[model samples]
Target: MAAEPVRIDDPADPRIAGFVSIRERDLTGREGLFIAEGTVVLRMLGQAQARANGFAAEAILLLESRLAGIAEVLAAFPPEVPVYIASQAVFDAIAGFNMHRGVLALGRKPSAQVGASLLGRLPGTSLVLAGCGLSNHDNVGSIFRNAAAFGADAVFLDETSCDPLYRKAIRVSVGSVLTVPFSRAMAGEAMLRGLAEAGFEIWGLSPRGQVSVAAIPPARRIALVLGTEGEGLPEHILASFRTARIPQRPGLDSLNVATASGIALYQIALAMGRVA
Candidate 1:
């Protein structure tokens, strides 16, 4: 059983300070920490803790009535992790808004690893998701979700890409951002170059791709390159890398980046025997 939760009658209490004014704080950076919301996400936080993968939950805050329902999830964390509970009035006041769901967690981001170092550690047979100039947090999170669902070994984001751990992004991803291992490349092209040098067959996804995703042959190591939703991949990337498209009815501009990622990852993952 999980330890009994501590009651917080004051929104200003220092122990629960990290969770105060959540919406406002989300607009600013979390400074190496992030808020995990909802039961599914909290469960993911618990799982991340279990893996000892460098992520840790510093504390959890719940609406007073939510504790019983989440007792099973709470039990997953170690005894030392504090669980704080508050009434609706106190929780809403602390959050600066109506706090309906009531499930929240403060989790620290893992230590950073350089792109080359992370890629070098991957096994010979691997699949990865590479993002270039992707600015949307939801897209970033969804990419990680697709990566996890399709068994992509890791995700690499260019410096221009948004942080996958952004709260809205994390919630939209259903917690995949916490589960998928990822690294950021300070120079986008340099990251791709390193992957290419590491023997990964990099395929850029574009609307004007020469081959349909279904037609691409399997490879021992592969990386799928994706870009922003409307602009798509850069010309230089398209010109240089082998590119693939998801065949669709003509006339629409393109698929949403998240949708395209799911479809593409599903196809490539199946071809590589990563998915059944």
Candidate 2:
């Protein structure tokens, strides 16, 4: 059953401290917790909690007017999870902005797992996305969205990559960050080597790649390695891994990493029999 809302009279209420000034704290905030905003994201968070895969909703804050609309969503979560409601003024003050969507959730990040450990656990047949120096949160989110769309088993990130759980990234991904399994590795090279050791055929995506993405054959396991936007996959990585290109026109230098990921994932997924 959906828990009855507890009205929040004060914007500075101690019970809702975690939600204060979300914009400022998003830049430098606590690690174990993340804000899940919007009805879609909150719904995904509820789904994540149902999975019980090391994720939980610490609390939910809503504009008093929105409680009725999200009743189904609230019902998905356990009654023990507190639901806090606030008037427009209090909600705006607490969030540091006019939160039009008015649906927000504090979700606990799952326990950390080492990159190699996560890679080692995947089944023999798997498709994965490996990101190197992908600092853009939106790109990170899109990558996970693409991975999930293409049925990738997991995503691996290097230390230089941005956290997918960043508020904007999570919204950009429409909550795929919470759904996809991901881990951060110490180094890009170490991540690639670990995937290789796990019997994953690693393919680095680069404009200068030797083969076209469509030409690449199927494999038992494949990891599509993506790099940052302008300065693409490092030369060393390009040299080390078998690379594939998207085959674009002469005027264009390269596709955005996120767009490139989606295209590559689609093609590779088809080859790997993950999609029709």
Number of clashes recorded per candidate:
0, 0
Off by over 4 Å in 2: 114-116
Model 1 lDDT per residue over 58-107, tens place? 99999999998989999999988999999999999888899799999999
lDDT of 1 at 271: 94
* Clash count (model 1, backbone only): 0
Evaluate all candidate structures by whole-model CA lDDT and list the values in order: 0.89, 0.90
User: Cα deviation of 160 in candidate 2 (Å)?
Assistant: 0.6
Query: Which sections of candidate 1 miss by over 4 Å?
Result: 1-3, 114-116
Error of 1 at 241 (Å): 1.0
- RMSD of candidate 1 to the truth, in angstroms, is 1.4
Work out the TM-score per prediction: 0.96, 0.97
